[model samples]
Target: MFVDQEGPDPNFSAIAAVADGRATVTVTGEVDMSTADDMLRAAMTDDVAATTLDLRRVTFFDSAAIHAVLQLADFHGPKLTVLPSAQVRRVLEISGLAGQPWLSD
Candidate 1:
């Protein structure tokens, strides 16, 4: 399954797909306060055994993005995985969450 969030140039888009009991949410563009909620909602697919948040295309990440990621981690625990882009990685490093178990190498 796949879902795409559409709006008036939100400067970001979150697309989710599910396969093999894992939901992969691919997010692109700026992820700030304005787009974080939508990003999170896109990732929160129902009845998936695992979730992978693919932020490799994200050019900007803010505290709100961090909060959304943290919320996902709290909810998904060991079943969550995050693939961060350079921008996202920098913020995660500053927030000291770069070493999190869920952060993919």
Candidate 2:
């Protein structure tokens, strides 16, 4: 089941769901200091076999969001896959996470 949360900003939203032994979190809008925690909470709920973060709709990402991803990876081991937006991809690359096994275009 997927549950959507209307965050404080219309430009930001997060939806969480689980299916086929994987937990999926789709986040939209800017993920920065103001929104990273919420994004983290939405994405890292359970220690499932796999976790997927769909960030294709995200327009912006910062260090706070990157830290959240790292935290999730730490908790879930190598079972986290992130589908990142162009903007996010650039940031990850800058953060030395580009071409990492856990990230997909």
lDDT of each: 0.90, 0.87
Please give the TM-score that candidate 1 achieves against the real structure: 0.89
lDDT of 1 by residue, 26-88 (tens): 999988777899999999877999999999999989898999999999888899999999889
Predicted model with the maximum lDDT: 1
Q: How close to the true structure is residue 51 of candidate 2, measured as C-alpha lDDT? A: 91
* Candidate 2 TM-score over all chains jointly: 0.86
Off by over 4 Å in 1: 1-9
Which regions of candidate 2 fall more than 4 Å away from where they truly are?
Answer: 1-8
Q: Residue-wise lDDT of candidate 2 within 27-95, one digit each (tens)? A: 999998778899989987675789999999999898889998888778777898999999999999999
Instruction: Give the CA lDDT, 0 to 100, for residue 88 in model 1.
Output: 91
RMSD to truth, every model: 6.4, 6.5
Clashes of each: 0, 0
Instruction: Show the lowest summed lDDT stretch of 10 residues, model 2.
Output: 1-10
